[model samples]
Target: MDWIDWGDAPTWLGAVFAAAAAGAAVWTLKSQRDQIDEQRRFIAEQSMNLGLERQALLAAAQERHEAQARKIRLYPQAPTYVQVVNDSDDPIYDVHCEARGMPALHAVELAPSEGVGAGILADLVQGASRPYVHRLGVGREAWFHVVTNERGAVHIRFTDAAGNKWVCDDAGGLHEAGA
Candidate 1:
């Protein structure tokens, strides 16, 4: 009997090639997944850093605003006497005080009825004196006077004819005129 000639290749060659292809496909998929995960992690890190930077900037700005607000709130508003020492020997002295949180003194009218401008400091320095007689005239006891003592330093205090006293300095705001 005549038998047909068979190819010299192994019967399992096709199956082996198919298995290798499947394995390579799985490995390629895993590698792609790993790359995608790394990209996602980098994006997340950048976002977190950006958020932190924004928070820090906002906090710094808020701190500065609060400090300025505190300064404005604490600054004196009532009649305040500020003595400035000039370094230059310029004969023309400049007395400059910004109203800041206080009402502008330029438009203020110190009348007897106001009960605020009768003080000697307002009348003498500001030239805003009224005709009404002071219950306690301007003197050592007046509640508004700046006196230059024997020393080069200047002294200022508020004294009422009724013997009320008030003084201002680094210690703190003036003690009540009568206190």
Candidate 2:
């Protein structure tokens, strides 16, 4: 192999290589720093946008529910319009005219002597203990489980039974008692 001549190398060539290496190092470092700053800025912007978008979505959903007339009407106007919802999906029994208006108060009563109306009454009376009164929506709206199996209250309301009123929940549970 031929021996390399370090002395013969041009003096300016070494300076040129050193200058280029330094320039390249500076460029690489600056580029990396700039990229890190840009990424941080991008992440911060996304977080702010997400928070705003979440609030907007919640507001929109609330607006949609509030705009519905039927849902609005479902909210009780008086304390008596509410009934305590038992945590069951059974049929309603012993529907009386007095129970029709809002629950006004929760009270326990003897089972109706007449027994529940034929069809749904049979189902509602199942496992039904002494009659109980629970003021629904007394202080606030309540989420009651509606039982639609028995239609006695529905029929009475449709036929216009005098002194007979009914409270129907959104889910179709109807309560009635002689007023």
* TM of each candidate vs. truth: 0.38, 0.35
Where model 2 places Cα greater than 4 Å from the true spot, the runs are: 1-12, 69-179
Cα lDDT of model 1 by residue, 4-96, tens digit: 334524546767888899999999999999999999999899999999999999999766533311221112323343321212211111121
In the range 26-117, model 2's lDDT, one tens digit per residue, is 99999999999999999999999999999999998755433321121132212222222322222223332223332222222222232223
What are the lDDT scores of the predictions, listed in order? 0.37, 0.38
Name model 1 segments beyond 4 Å from true. Answer: 1-11, 61-73, 76-102, 106-120, 123-179
Candidate 1 — worst ten consecutive residues by lDDT sum? 85-94
Question: lDDT at 130 for candidate 2?
Answer: 26
The numbered model that scores best in lDDT is 2
Query: Local error of candidate 1 at 22, Å?
Result: 1.8
Q: Cα RMSD to native, each candidate?
A: 15.4, 14.1
Give the total clashing residue pairs for model 2. 16
Instruction: Kindly provide the TM-score of model 2 when superposed on the true structure, using C-alpha atoms.
Output: 0.35
